[model samples]
Target chain A: MSEDRIDIGGIADEYVLGLLDAIEARQVETDMESDPDLKAAIAASRDRFLPLDDTAEPTVIGDDLWTRIDAALPVQGAAPIDVSRLTANDNRPGGWRATALAAMAAAVILAVALSVNLMRTIEPLVVAVLVNEAGDIQAIVEDFGNEKAAVRLLADFTVPQGKTIEVWTLPSPERGPVSLGLIDDARSVRLDGPALPKPHDSQLYELTLEQAGGSPTGRPTGLILAKGFAKITR
Target chain B: MVTGAAPDDLTTALAACAKGDRTALRGIFDREAGRLVTIAERIVRRRDLAEEVVQESFIRIWTQAHQYQPDRGSARGWIYAIVRNRALNLLRDSKREYTVEDVELLRERDQVDHVMAAWHRLDRTSRLHDCLGALDDTKRRGILMAYIGGYSHGEIAGRLSIPLGTTKSWIRRGLSALRECMA
Candidate 1:
């Protein structure tokens, strides 16, 4: 390998080893976005030192700690929905109610389709109902074992002029978001999962409106239209 | 090292967590919280703050479970990495004033004798124990102090009475050697 590659790998090693100071660590994280090689090197280094995690002595924790953490979690059902409050005293005839009724009908059809699809697959599979801010299902991601996955859009979405929708996943917060690919159409699209890591439940799948081709910065650079967490269906 | 959740189990639980399964999150907490608390306490040196770190780290783990990649590393490592980073950030951000005596005490407590005792307790057949055994005392101790104790280069240098540059090189080279040996 070239000296330049070795140098990058060495720095990645230090970063993974926690030898880098805060400033250097932050720089590596920024570089990782625009630099795939750097990201791979860091991943390799992380794997190298993984065994070291065994060295820490197991300590007992206070019984209340788990409760405290559980209490602080964002309610899973906290998806943006204000229709309930609005429905309470709406004298207006069929305003939000009409839209909501249509949405619910769509959801029921999608659920039935999903259940049928789930029955056909023998392998352990995970799925995510990607929802917009208003809690409308925009897309559904079905991940089969290994790195194979498919994304199906549930609602009609027109990519704004001079823009395209891109898919991204957050594997871990520290690692930041990794681009999955650009969505060409809203129908069922096969995701290039092998190029990315395996999909895990609670993993987030999001669609962001980016420049026509994609985000030039390698990170999401536009408004996130929809996001949701994957869950195991098996 | 003895792990509560096997790698596959941890990975499965994390996946379930991503699916918003509180049961899966509870499973992980039940299995790993004790060890995580210990790891954080070692770095932060306070039980209460360490517990807080565990709390925050678990929440992150629950919220971000989908992000764990088996290809990158073991699920246990990924989980512990979050806890360690959170504790280290808290310690560094707070800029806790450590008296000279406290530093000396930590250094003394992390001496080779103590570290070796911990190392020997690990399964002797494990690759980590064998590879770590191959390193010279200074290199081994330097790496261990950084990972387990969360000691910065400056602190490691102070403890070892070595120049900062030498200490840095030792750790960097030590890790490189470990990578090669483990591979």
Candidate 2:
């Protein structure tokens, strides 16, 4: 917890006010992808300044504008893969319906565990039920929103001679996938990962098979053995 | 004239967008486009460019609707953020070609008037209106120009004919003060 300190100066305010230079502003956007406090600060500032936006007169949009926009929309019904909504009744293309049931069961167990442990432990900000390609529940990830996350493996993996199971999360598009930590013995452990924006609904979490130390690129380069989206804890 | 769509309706529309409902996107457009265009036009200063910004923003909204987290903030705020960022980016990339002296002499009046109009329009009873009333004139004006006009630090300083350092401090301090007063 000693490492929880952050010093972003007042850039959040400047960022929200549109005062930072272009480069600095972009940098702040990148920083917010991994810094929850900064994200929250900027969000707060944006909300506060929102009243100013309402002052503008609502001018009529050019009639052709919507036509242009309508023409440019992505092809309908080609919805992007949204694993967060994967459920036992999903009739979507992916044959995920089978394992989704197991995933739900795992989530039910997690919910009960969460309730039973409510008064005994720090509540998680989001919980994800990781599943293998076959839809078997593989692990559970509990992100604490303090740069710390817990990985509790429900299934064993044969970590070949020099390979290890690594935990990863997609904090934002700019940050890409970040390595949370490495699991060497298939044991439950809490990983003090690098700071990240507070987990949001549908944030991706996964486990990958990687070289012993970790991916060389600081990304998930190995085979993804399990993956799921974070369901924010109530 | 629409005081923005009701928050829950907008939220529901966004959810439907996530499910690939095009009509939902249209509903949002029908409800928010007029104001979104106006908001972007203030920052970009051109109707055509502002329309372009709003158009691009809608595409993004439709594609990324699933990413909106209901618990984090209001859906209307989220949509307005998309438009504002696009408008600001367009304004920044083209660099507006205005010399500091030209900006000060020619655009200062309009910018100040723009910001002042917004401040005056704030609901008389709202905390925002009262908190802003409490700020020093310079600080309040500096904050408003940056926010309403999307002026960068240099631009705000140039528009106000103040030292760049003074403009930065005023904005930073003004925002912090505004946060405290609102709190």
Looking at candidate 1, what is the lDDT of residue A156? 88
Residue-wise lDDT of candidate 2 within A1-234, one digit each (tens)? 422322243676677666777677767867776877777766766677677777777887645678767766665346345333332122221223235435755675674485345334788888888886457778888888899888888888878898888999877543457889999887878899998889876677888877799887676656667877777777
The whole-model lDDT of each prediction reads 0.68, 0.72
Q: Per-residue lDDT for B111 in model 1?
A: 50
State the lDDT at B95 in candidate 2. Answer: 42
Q: Residue-wise lDDT of candidate 2 within B66-156, one digit each (tens)?
A: 8777543678877898788777775654343223343344335465677778778877777788898899988888888878888878877
Candidate with the greatest DockQ versus the true structure: 2
Give candidate 2's error at residue A171 in angstroms.
43
Those runs of model 2 whose alpha carbons end farther than 4 Å from true positions after fitting are A1-9, A76-234, B1-3, B96-109
State the fnat of candidate 1 relative to the true structure: 0.39
User: Deviation in angstroms for A95 in model 2?
Assistant: 35
